[model samples]
Target: MKTILELSMKSVTLAVVLTAGAALAGCSEINGVMNDLQTMTTSNLPEQGIAQPTNKNAVSLKTDLVGLVGWFENSCGFDPVFYTEGTKENQVQKRFDTFQESFMAKQYKTDGSYTAYVKPDYRSKLPANYREAVKNISVVEDSTGVHYYVDFNNATYRGYDLSRLELFYQPESDYVYDTLYFKNANFVDLKSVFKTTRDDLDELRGGEFDAKSRSVMCYLGL
Candidate 1:
């Protein structure tokens, strides 16, 4: 038979163990909740500039588009090489280099036209609520290619409203093998603008044209 003191000590020891286990469980649950909150906050951060998409295809597409938008915003439409779909060794960079050389030599004279055109107006048209605005992206795949459509939700320019911006990608060997298309304000096809700019530059410089440089010039209205 156990003494009263021994029984009392055993009861106290069991209570202590149970209390410690409860405390550990409570701490674990709290830590899990905190971790989940941190993940939610990080994913929705403003600087990230994108929300998680439900579409599986949009997962990779969202990352690519966000990067392109960020680059365009950063460059103010000057750096086209980043958005242009091609390798560095391709003719795009070479032509851009040539154009830069001519511009530096004053063969092409600019009256602050490109800067004035792109600086204020282009940025003004961008979505104010970037993260929320670009959250939903729709993907359509067909015989032509895979098309990812991004709706600006509330962004517009001039009298023209931007309903949908489409990015067409034809997958070939894990590389972007075609030009990117942007339908500006649901009215203007930016590809045509790029072509026209390229033609003008060719007429001015009388040299091989760069598609990448033309893209920048189109944004600048040069």
Candidate 2:
């Protein structure tokens, strides 16, 4: 059960940075880049909370949670774009209700293993064409049936609002599942910083490593 998430761009540290006051216009939509990242990771937060006494009532609680998220943004200097974007909200709600309703309708034992929730649609906030481009992303498997994606634009569409809603039916997937990320991704920020550090590294290709025969390669001809 290997989950191979290929950015197809050779390297996948793509990011879209938006300067303040700049509205996203004429870009690749950079939609769902965040959701794409989340879907690739698994999350444990939902299992940790107080189970809503009644599933029907859970939506209200969940909606409040959403409001709380909004409030936190206003109260703190946090970015709303970071939280709101990305998720299949309606689908998740429908699924959650379905999961609860089925126990009685199907006359089956409650499968504790079953779970339901929505995942953000990373492309939700994007303009229509971009959203279509994102949805066109086909989920494929190799000859070995290991699923992977290919050929997405290497553009980092910033403005964190571009997002997705993820619903977890099973827990074994490779993607992380927290609202933000599996862990504090300092490495992500680090990659952005390192993006500027290229000095001739970019000019060199994989063949350069193949040609290197010694530890002195960098200084051999100097």
Candidate 3:
């Protein structure tokens, strides 16, 4: 439950600033980054008038056990290479090791789902009561188990598509229902910004840059 401002101040502030200063001076992508910082942290504005009713479709318990397990194992694991370049391997590994300890799924529920808790080790980085206030993430699998229905526990900034908002999955089908309404994210703009910055860095460093990072979805045990 850490606030958006706090996360920016603690995690990406310096790095982003330095990158902007070094590569693209006075580019608008910096504004997009700032906009994302502000928008992604807070809850979406409430809907107008009466709230929409939950779907009446029956909840399905039939799950693809193997697919679900495989997804979870992959999602919760983190790789150091994604966090930094070759020179910072040890630093990335240390940080990722700590992240894995807390994020890795530990228990299989009797209800045929997987859950994970935020470990005490992350207490200092997270809100004081996050361990309790933030509930375990529940992963509900589809019939084929190729897809999943997962809860975000009201997370701040859930990646490019705002994937962590309150979402409903039809137990019998792959229908995903998102409660929040947001403008279509300009991923093209975001991607262009990243690529531009990356290209500049590569040119400056004689093409030594490596764009390798692990998928956050896979690291979350999927």
Using lDDT as the measure, the top candidate is 1
Cα displacement (angstroms), candidate 2, residue 197, comes to 22
When 2 and 3 are scored with lDDT, the better candidate is 3
Whole-structure CA lDDT of model 1: 0.35
Give the C-alpha miss distance for residue 102 in model 2, angstroms.
24
Query: What residue runs in model 2 are displaced by over 4 Å at the alpha carbon?
Result: 1-81, 84-129, 132-135, 141-150, 153-190, 193-222
lDDT of the structure predicted as candidate 3: 0.32
Which tens-of-lDDT digit does each residue in 16-103 have in candidate 2?
A: 4342224565243445555655565433122232222233212211111221122112211122222343543433333333432322
Clash counts per candidate, in order, are 0, 36, 11
Local error of candidate 1 at 82, Å? Answer: 6.4
Model 2's C-alpha root-mean-square deviation from the true structure amounts to 24.5
Candidate 3 lDDT, 2-100, residue by residue in tens: 222335355566767666765656556777777885685343322332122222221111111111112112212133233455544444344534433
lDDT of model 2 at position 57: 16
Looking at model 2, residue 107 earns an lDDT score of 21
Ranking by TM-score: 1, 3, 2
Against the true structure, candidate 3 reaches a TM-score of 0.26
Per-model TM-score, in order, reads: 0.27, 0.18, 0.26
Clashing pairs in 1: none
Which runs of model 1 end up more than 4 angstroms from their true locations?
1-129, 173-222
